[model samples]
Target: MIRTKIISTWTILLVCGAQAGILESPNYYHDYAPTFHHYHPQPRPQPHYIHCTPEVHNVIEVIPPPVIVRVVEKRRQTAKDLLDLICRALTDMGGIASEDNPEIGARIIAKLNIEKDTATLIYAEWKDGVNYRSRRFKRQAAGEDRVKNELGDLLTKAGDVIESDKEKLSPAAQDKIDSRHERAVDDCQADVCKSHAAKRNRIKEAKAARKG
Candidate 1:
Protein backbone atom coordinates (compact mmCIF):
# COMPACT_ATOMS: atom_id res chain seq x y z
CA MET A 1 0.00 0.00 0.00
CA ILE A 2 2.94 2.42 0.60
CA ARG A 3 4.41 1.63 -2.81
CA THR A 4 1.07 2.47 -4.37
CA LYS A 5 0.94 5.82 -2.55
CA ILE A 6 4.55 6.73 -3.56
CA ILE A 7 3.75 5.94 -7.22
CA SER A 8 0.66 8.20 -7.10
CA THR A 9 2.74 11.04 -5.61
CA TRP A 10 5.45 10.69 -8.31
CA THR A 11 2.80 10.75 -11.06
CA ILE A 12 1.27 13.98 -9.66
CA LEU A 13 4.68 15.71 -9.50
CA LEU A 14 5.55 14.68 -13.13
CA VAL A 15 2.24 16.23 -14.33
CA CYS A 16 2.98 19.54 -12.49
CA GLY A 17 6.51 19.71 -13.85
CA ALA A 18 5.23 19.12 -17.41
CA GLN A 19 2.64 21.95 -17.02
CA ALA A 20 5.33 24.40 -15.74
CA GLY A 21 7.69 23.58 -18.66
CA ILE A 22 4.90 24.27 -21.17
CA LEU A 23 4.23 27.74 -19.69
CA GLU A 24 7.91 28.79 -19.59
CA SER A 25 8.81 27.78 -23.28
CA PRO A 26 9.00 30.90 -25.73
CA ASN A 27 8.13 28.95 -29.07
CA TYR A 28 5.34 26.79 -27.68
CA TYR A 29 2.70 28.28 -30.18
CA HIS A 30 5.17 29.85 -32.81
CA ASP A 31 3.87 27.89 -35.89
CA TYR A 32 0.18 27.54 -34.88
CA ALA A 33 -0.74 31.31 -34.36
CA PRO A 34 -1.66 33.73 -37.24
CA THR A 35 1.24 36.06 -38.43
CA PHE A 36 1.01 39.89 -39.25
CA HIS A 37 3.52 41.80 -41.53
CA HIS A 38 3.75 45.57 -42.63
CA TYR A 39 3.60 45.84 -46.50
CA HIS A 40 4.20 49.09 -48.68
CA PRO A 41 2.89 49.45 -52.31
CA GLN A 42 5.57 50.33 -54.95
CA PRO A 43 4.87 52.96 -57.80
CA ARG A 44 4.93 51.88 -61.52
CA PRO A 45 7.60 53.36 -63.87
CA GLN A 46 6.53 55.79 -66.77
CA PRO A 47 7.67 55.41 -70.43
CA HIS A 48 10.21 58.03 -71.87
CA TYR A 49 9.37 59.98 -75.06
CA ILE A 50 11.79 61.69 -77.64
CA HIS A 51 11.08 65.46 -77.39
CA CYS A 52 14.19 66.79 -79.36
CA THR A 53 13.13 65.53 -82.84
CA PRO A 54 11.31 67.94 -85.32
CA GLU A 55 8.16 66.81 -87.26
CA VAL A 56 8.12 67.05 -91.09
CA HIS A 57 5.22 67.89 -93.52
CA ASN A 58 4.73 68.74 -97.22
CA VAL A 59 4.55 72.53 -98.12
CA ILE A 60 2.51 73.85 -101.07
CA GLU A 61 3.35 77.11 -103.00
CA VAL A 62 0.61 79.56 -104.12
CA ILE A 63 0.89 82.06 -107.05
CA PRO A 64 -0.93 85.39 -107.47
CA PRO A 65 -2.73 86.66 -110.68
CA PRO A 66 -1.07 89.14 -113.09
CA VAL A 67 -2.09 92.81 -113.37
CA ILE A 68 -3.13 94.41 -116.70
CA VAL A 69 -2.26 97.92 -117.98
CA ARG A 70 -4.07 100.14 -120.54
CA VAL A 71 -2.61 102.70 -122.93
CA VAL A 72 -4.23 105.77 -124.64
CA GLU A 73 -3.44 107.21 -128.09
CA LYS A 74 -2.19 110.76 -128.62
CA ARG A 75 -4.13 113.34 -130.66
CA ARG A 76 -2.86 114.55 -134.06
CA GLN A 77 -2.30 118.26 -134.87
CA THR A 78 -3.96 120.09 -137.80
CA ALA A 79 -3.53 123.23 -139.99
CA LYS A 80 -5.25 125.36 -137.32
CA ASP A 81 -2.59 124.26 -134.87
CA LEU A 82 0.13 125.44 -137.28
CA LEU A 83 -1.50 128.91 -137.55
CA ASP A 84 -1.77 129.24 -133.79
CA LEU A 85 1.92 128.31 -133.41
CA ILE A 86 2.85 131.06 -135.89
CA CYS A 87 0.74 133.65 -134.07
CA ARG A 88 2.31 132.74 -130.72
CA ALA A 89 5.81 132.91 -132.24
CA LEU A 90 5.16 136.39 -133.64
CA THR A 91 3.75 137.59 -130.35
CA ASP A 92 6.85 136.36 -128.46
CA MET A 93 9.10 138.29 -130.88
CA GLY A 94 7.31 141.59 -129.82
CA GLY A 95 5.57 142.18 -133.21
CA ILE A 96 6.14 142.36 -137.00
CA ALA A 97 5.18 145.10 -139.56
CA SER A 98 5.89 145.87 -143.25
CA GLU A 99 8.03 148.81 -144.49
CA ASP A 100 6.93 151.45 -147.00
CA ASN A 101 8.10 151.06 -150.60
CA PRO A 102 8.76 153.56 -153.50
CA GLU A 103 7.06 151.38 -156.11
CA ILE A 104 3.30 151.78 -156.63
CA GLY A 105 1.76 148.74 -154.90
CA ALA A 106 -0.54 147.35 -152.22
CA ARG A 107 0.92 146.11 -148.87
CA ILE A 108 -0.20 144.08 -145.87
CA ILE A 109 1.32 144.33 -142.35
CA ALA A 110 0.59 142.25 -139.19
CA LYS A 111 0.84 143.58 -135.62
CA LEU A 112 0.23 141.79 -132.29
CA ASN A 113 -1.01 144.11 -129.51
CA ILE A 114 0.40 144.26 -125.95
CA GLU A 115 -2.48 142.07 -124.64
CA LYS A 116 -1.12 139.23 -126.85
CA ASP A 117 -4.67 137.95 -127.39
CA THR A 118 -5.60 140.36 -130.20
CA ALA A 119 -3.91 140.59 -133.63
CA THR A 120 -4.28 143.35 -136.24
CA LEU A 121 -3.68 143.21 -140.02
CA ILE A 122 -3.27 146.39 -142.06
CA TYR A 123 -3.87 146.77 -145.81
CA ALA A 124 -2.56 149.84 -147.62
CA GLU A 125 -1.89 151.18 -151.12
CA TRP A 126 1.43 152.94 -151.64
CA LYS A 127 2.61 155.33 -154.42
CA ASP A 128 5.77 157.48 -154.47
CA GLY A 129 6.70 156.12 -150.94
CA VAL A 130 3.40 157.47 -149.51
CA ASN A 131 0.40 155.42 -148.22
CA TYR A 132 -2.56 156.36 -150.37
CA ARG A 133 -5.34 154.15 -148.98
CA SER A 134 -5.42 152.14 -145.75
CA ARG A 135 -7.68 149.61 -143.97
CA ARG A 136 -7.41 147.97 -140.53
CA PHE A 137 -8.69 144.47 -139.58
CA LYS A 138 -8.59 142.80 -136.19
CA ARG A 139 -8.92 139.18 -134.98
CA GLN A 140 -8.23 137.02 -131.93
CA ALA A 141 -4.75 135.47 -131.72
CA ALA A 142 -5.85 131.95 -130.64
CA GLY A 143 -8.92 129.72 -130.15
CA GLU A 144 -10.73 126.62 -131.50
CA ASP A 145 -13.10 128.16 -134.08
CA ARG A 146 -13.69 131.96 -134.23
CA VAL A 147 -10.01 132.97 -133.98
CA LYS A 148 -8.90 130.49 -136.67
CA ASN A 149 -11.76 131.34 -139.09
CA GLU A 150 -11.38 135.09 -138.66
CA LEU A 151 -7.59 134.91 -139.12
CA GLY A 152 -8.01 132.78 -142.28
CA ASP A 153 -10.42 135.32 -143.80
CA LEU A 154 -8.08 138.22 -143.00
CA LEU A 155 -5.11 136.36 -144.54
CA THR A 156 -7.08 135.73 -147.77
CA LYS A 157 -8.15 139.39 -148.08
CA ALA A 158 -4.55 140.60 -147.41
CA GLY A 159 -3.37 138.65 -150.51
CA ASP A 160 0.08 137.09 -150.89
CA VAL A 161 1.90 139.94 -152.75
CA ILE A 162 1.87 143.77 -152.64
CA GLU A 163 2.76 144.39 -156.35
CA SER A 164 0.24 145.72 -158.89
CA ASP A 165 -0.47 144.23 -162.38
CA LYS A 166 0.07 147.63 -163.93
CA GLU A 167 3.71 147.73 -162.74
CA LYS A 168 4.34 144.33 -164.40
CA LEU A 169 5.77 144.47 -167.94
CA SER A 170 3.59 143.12 -170.77
CA PRO A 171 4.55 139.93 -172.66
CA ALA A 172 5.28 141.95 -175.83
CA ALA A 173 7.61 144.26 -173.89
CA GLN A 174 9.34 141.28 -172.17
CA ASP A 175 9.80 139.46 -175.48
CA LYS A 176 11.22 142.57 -177.20
CA ILE A 177 15.10 142.43 -177.12
CA ASP A 178 17.76 144.96 -178.18
CA SER A 179 19.35 143.70 -181.41
CA ARG A 180 22.48 145.71 -180.68
CA HIS A 181 23.29 143.62 -177.47
CA GLU A 182 21.88 140.23 -178.45
CA ARG A 183 24.83 138.23 -177.03
CA ALA A 184 26.65 138.37 -173.65
CA VAL A 185 28.81 141.55 -173.57
CA ASP A 186 31.51 140.00 -171.32
CA ASP A 187 33.39 136.64 -171.31
CA CYS A 188 32.62 136.04 -167.53
CA GLN A 189 28.87 136.39 -168.19
CA ALA A 190 29.06 133.96 -171.14
CA ASP A 191 30.84 131.34 -168.98
CA VAL A 192 28.19 131.70 -166.23
CA CYS A 193 25.41 131.14 -168.76
CA LYS A 194 27.23 128.05 -170.14
CA SER A 195 27.58 126.59 -166.61
CA HIS A 196 23.83 127.15 -165.86
CA ALA A 197 22.96 125.43 -169.20
CA ALA A 198 25.16 122.43 -168.37
CA LYS A 199 23.54 122.05 -164.86
CA ARG A 200 20.06 122.10 -166.40
CA ASN A 201 21.09 119.44 -168.95
CA ARG A 202 22.45 117.13 -166.19
CA ILE A 203 19.19 117.45 -164.16
CA LYS A 204 17.11 116.62 -167.28
CA GLU A 205 19.23 113.51 -168.03
CA ALA A 206 18.85 112.25 -164.42
CA LYS A 207 15.03 112.75 -164.52
CA ALA A 208 14.78 110.89 -167.89
CA ALA A 209 16.78 107.95 -166.56
CA ARG A 210 14.51 107.64 -163.47
CA LYS A 211 11.37 107.74 -165.61
CA GLY A 212 12.74 105.10 -167.98
Candidate 2:
Protein backbone atom coordinates (compact mmCIF):
# COMPACT_ATOMS: atom_id res chain seq x y z
CA MET A 1 0.00 0.00 0.00
CA ILE A 2 2.85 2.53 0.73
CA ARG A 3 4.57 1.78 -2.61
CA THR A 4 1.26 2.48 -4.44
CA LYS A 5 0.89 5.84 -2.71
CA ILE A 6 4.52 6.93 -3.55
CA ILE A 7 3.87 6.01 -7.20
CA SER A 8 0.72 8.20 -7.35
CA THR A 9 2.59 11.21 -5.85
CA TRP A 10 5.42 10.97 -8.36
CA THR A 11 2.85 10.80 -11.30
CA ILE A 12 1.02 13.94 -9.96
CA LEU A 13 4.34 15.91 -9.80
CA LEU A 14 5.18 15.04 -13.47
CA VAL A 15 1.70 16.16 -14.67
CA CYS A 16 2.08 19.61 -12.97
CA GLY A 17 5.56 20.15 -14.47
CA ALA A 18 4.22 19.39 -18.01
CA GLN A 19 1.29 21.89 -17.60
CA ALA A 20 3.71 24.76 -16.54
CA GLY A 21 6.06 24.10 -19.50
CA ILE A 22 3.09 24.33 -22.02
CA LEU A 23 2.01 27.78 -20.60
CA GLU A 24 5.55 29.21 -20.90
CA SER A 25 6.07 28.10 -24.60
CA PRO A 26 6.44 31.00 -27.22
CA ASN A 27 3.77 29.49 -29.64
CA TYR A 28 1.13 29.18 -26.90
CA TYR A 29 -2.41 29.99 -28.20
CA HIS A 30 -4.70 32.34 -26.24
CA ASP A 31 -7.73 34.50 -26.92
CA TYR A 32 -5.31 37.19 -28.53
CA ALA A 33 -2.20 36.54 -30.66
CA PRO A 34 0.50 38.90 -32.21
CA THR A 35 0.92 38.64 -36.02
CA PHE A 36 4.52 38.57 -37.57
CA HIS A 37 5.83 38.64 -41.26
CA HIS A 38 9.23 37.27 -42.43
CA TYR A 39 9.04 38.21 -46.17
CA HIS A 40 8.29 42.04 -46.55
CA PRO A 41 7.48 43.49 -49.98
CA GLN A 42 10.45 45.63 -51.24
CA PRO A 43 9.57 49.29 -51.96
CA ARG A 44 8.41 49.63 -55.60
CA PRO A 45 11.31 51.09 -57.64
CA GLN A 46 10.62 54.70 -58.90
CA PRO A 47 9.56 54.85 -62.61
CA HIS A 48 12.39 56.15 -64.89
CA TYR A 49 11.79 58.57 -67.86
CA ILE A 50 13.76 58.19 -71.11
CA HIS A 51 15.44 61.38 -72.45
CA CYS A 52 14.88 62.20 -76.18
CA THR A 53 17.02 64.51 -78.34
CA PRO A 54 15.33 67.50 -80.03
CA GLU A 55 15.24 67.70 -83.81
CA VAL A 56 17.26 70.54 -85.47
CA HIS A 57 15.80 72.62 -88.30
CA ASN A 58 17.51 75.01 -90.74
CA VAL A 59 16.80 78.74 -90.16
CA ILE A 60 15.75 81.08 -92.97
CA GLU A 61 17.17 84.61 -93.15
CA VAL A 62 15.17 87.68 -94.23
CA ILE A 63 16.64 90.33 -96.53
CA PRO A 64 15.74 94.02 -96.70
CA PRO A 65 14.45 95.79 -99.83
CA PRO A 66 16.83 97.57 -102.23
CA VAL A 67 16.97 101.35 -102.59
CA ILE A 68 15.93 103.15 -105.77
CA VAL A 69 18.08 105.77 -107.50
CA ARG A 70 16.75 108.80 -109.37
CA VAL A 71 18.76 110.59 -112.03
CA VAL A 72 18.24 114.25 -113.07
CA GLU A 73 19.53 115.77 -116.30
CA LYS A 74 21.10 119.26 -116.21
CA ARG A 75 21.27 121.65 -119.18
CA ARG A 76 24.24 123.99 -119.70
CA GLN A 77 24.77 126.81 -122.25
CA THR A 78 27.80 128.72 -123.56
CA ALA A 79 28.07 132.14 -125.39
CA LYS A 80 30.46 131.53 -128.33
CA ASP A 81 27.92 131.65 -131.21
CA LEU A 82 26.43 135.08 -130.33
CA LEU A 83 29.87 136.72 -130.68
CA ASP A 84 30.27 135.40 -134.22
CA LEU A 85 26.81 136.63 -135.19
CA ILE A 86 27.65 140.12 -133.89
CA CYS A 87 30.94 140.29 -135.81
CA ARG A 88 29.18 139.23 -139.01
CA ALA A 89 26.45 141.81 -138.44
CA LEU A 90 29.06 144.55 -138.02
CA THR A 91 30.86 143.48 -141.21
CA ASP A 92 27.55 143.51 -143.07
CA MET A 93 26.96 147.06 -141.83
CA GLY A 94 29.84 148.19 -144.20
CA GLY A 95 31.83 150.03 -141.50
CA ILE A 96 35.59 150.22 -142.08
CA ALA A 97 37.39 147.61 -139.96
CA SER A 98 39.49 149.22 -137.23
CA GLU A 99 41.64 147.95 -134.34
CA ASP A 100 39.67 150.31 -132.12
CA ASN A 101 36.49 148.52 -133.19
CA PRO A 102 35.35 145.95 -130.65
CA GLU A 103 36.88 142.54 -131.35
CA ILE A 104 34.39 139.70 -131.14
CA GLY A 105 36.26 138.24 -128.15
CA ALA A 106 36.43 141.53 -126.22
CA ARG A 107 32.79 142.38 -126.91
CA ILE A 108 31.63 138.95 -125.74
CA ILE A 109 33.73 139.12 -122.57
CA ALA A 110 32.43 142.60 -121.79
CA LYS A 111 28.74 141.98 -122.53
CA LEU A 112 28.70 138.74 -120.58
CA ASN A 113 28.08 139.33 -116.86
CA ILE A 114 29.30 135.84 -116.08
CA GLU A 115 31.15 135.90 -112.74
CA LYS A 116 32.31 132.34 -113.19
CA ASP A 117 33.51 130.45 -116.26
CA THR A 118 34.28 132.10 -119.63
CA ALA A 119 31.61 133.67 -121.86
CA THR A 120 31.72 132.13 -125.29
CA LEU A 121 31.27 134.54 -128.25
CA ILE A 122 27.77 134.56 -129.76
CA TYR A 123 27.14 137.88 -131.52
CA ALA A 124 28.92 141.25 -131.88
CA GLU A 125 28.42 144.69 -133.55
CA TRP A 126 30.31 147.97 -133.68
CA LYS A 127 29.31 151.54 -134.61
CA ASP A 128 32.41 153.76 -135.11
CA GLY A 129 35.12 153.18 -132.43
CA VAL A 130 33.11 153.69 -129.24
CA ASN A 131 29.57 152.67 -129.96
CA TYR A 132 29.39 148.87 -129.87
CA ARG A 133 26.80 146.32 -128.88
CA SER A 134 26.87 142.52 -128.51
CA ARG A 135 24.54 139.72 -127.60
CA ARG A 136 25.77 136.70 -125.68
CA PHE A 137 23.39 134.05 -126.83
CA LYS A 138 22.32 131.08 -124.69
CA ARG A 139 19.95 128.35 -125.82
CA GLN A 140 17.69 129.02 -122.83
CA ALA A 141 14.16 130.24 -123.59
CA ALA A 142 14.66 133.63 -121.93
CA GLY A 143 17.89 134.26 -123.84
CA GLU A 144 16.48 132.78 -127.05
CA ASP A 145 13.47 135.09 -126.95
CA ARG A 146 15.72 138.10 -126.46
CA VAL A 147 17.91 137.01 -129.40
CA LYS A 148 14.83 136.54 -131.59
CA ASN A 149 13.59 140.01 -130.83
CA GLU A 150 17.09 141.50 -131.40
CA LEU A 151 17.45 139.52 -134.66
CA GLY A 152 14.24 141.12 -135.98
CA ASP A 153 15.69 144.57 -135.37
CA LEU A 154 18.96 143.53 -136.98
CA LEU A 155 17.02 142.33 -140.03
CA THR A 156 15.58 145.83 -140.48
CA LYS A 157 19.11 147.32 -140.46
CA ALA A 158 20.28 144.64 -142.87
CA GLY A 159 17.48 145.63 -145.22
CA ASP A 160 18.73 149.24 -145.10
CA VAL A 161 22.21 148.02 -146.12
CA ILE A 162 20.70 146.24 -149.14
CA GLU A 163 18.59 149.26 -150.08
CA SER A 164 21.66 151.53 -149.88
CA ASP A 165 23.60 149.16 -152.18
CA LYS A 166 20.77 148.24 -154.54
CA GLU A 167 22.95 149.11 -157.57
CA LYS A 168 25.84 146.98 -156.28
CA LEU A 169 23.78 143.78 -156.24
CA SER A 170 21.85 142.37 -159.24
CA PRO A 171 18.13 141.71 -158.80
CA ALA A 172 18.93 137.98 -158.62
CA ALA A 173 21.62 138.58 -155.94
CA GLN A 174 19.24 140.70 -153.89
CA ASP A 175 16.54 138.06 -154.23
CA LYS A 176 18.94 135.40 -153.08
CA ILE A 177 20.09 137.50 -150.07
CA ASP A 178 16.46 138.28 -149.22
CA SER A 179 15.62 134.58 -149.34
CA ARG A 180 18.49 133.75 -146.98
CA HIS A 181 17.34 136.36 -144.52
CA GLU A 182 13.82 135.05 -144.71
CA ARG A 183 15.07 131.52 -144.03
CA ALA A 184 17.03 132.79 -141.01
CA VAL A 185 13.91 134.46 -139.69
CA ASP A 186 11.95 131.26 -140.18
CA ASP A 187 14.62 129.32 -138.30
CA CYS A 188 14.52 131.78 -135.42
CA GLN A 189 10.74 131.43 -135.22
CA ALA A 190 11.17 127.68 -135.17
CA ASP A 191 13.49 128.02 -132.12
CA VAL A 192 16.37 126.59 -134.17
CA CYS A 193 18.63 129.61 -133.71
CA LYS A 194 21.90 129.17 -131.76
CA SER A 195 20.48 131.66 -129.26
CA HIS A 196 19.62 131.13 -125.57
CA ALA A 197 15.89 131.47 -126.40
CA ALA A 198 15.58 127.96 -127.84
CA LYS A 199 17.47 126.27 -124.99
CA ARG A 200 15.51 128.05 -122.28
CA ASN A 201 12.24 127.16 -123.96
CA ARG A 202 13.23 123.50 -124.28
CA ILE A 203 14.31 123.28 -120.67
CA LYS A 204 11.13 124.96 -119.47
CA GLU A 205 9.02 122.58 -121.53
CA ALA A 206 10.93 119.56 -120.27
CA LYS A 207 10.48 120.59 -116.65
CA ALA A 208 6.80 121.20 -117.22
CA ALA A 209 6.36 117.79 -118.78
CA ARG A 210 8.11 116.12 -115.86
CA LYS A 211 5.81 117.88 -113.40
CA GLY A 212 2.76 116.93 -115.38
Best-fitting candidate, scored by TM-score: 2
Which segments of candidate 2 are over 4 A away from where they belong?
A: 1-144, 190-212
- RMSD of each predicted structure: 34.6, 29.4
Per-residue CA lDDT of model 1 for 1-212, tens digit only, reads: 99999999998888767655654555352222242222222333456996653432344466778877777764443324424543543332221221122121121122223212332321111112232252321122222234334443332222222123222434332222111111211111223334544664699799999999
CA lDDT, every model vs. true structure: 0.35, 0.42
What is the C-alpha local distance difference test score of candidate 1? 0.35
Per-residue alpha-carbon lDDT of candidate 2 for residues 119-203, written as tens digits (9 for 90 to 100): 1212222112122242422223345445444544453344444454433544554555455544433333323344444554688
In model 2, the Cα lDDT at residue 163 comes to 52
> What TM-score number comes out for model 2?
0.26
For all predicted structures, in order, the TM-scores are 0.18, 0.26
Where model 1 places Cα greater than 4 Å from the true spot, the runs are 1-143, 160-212
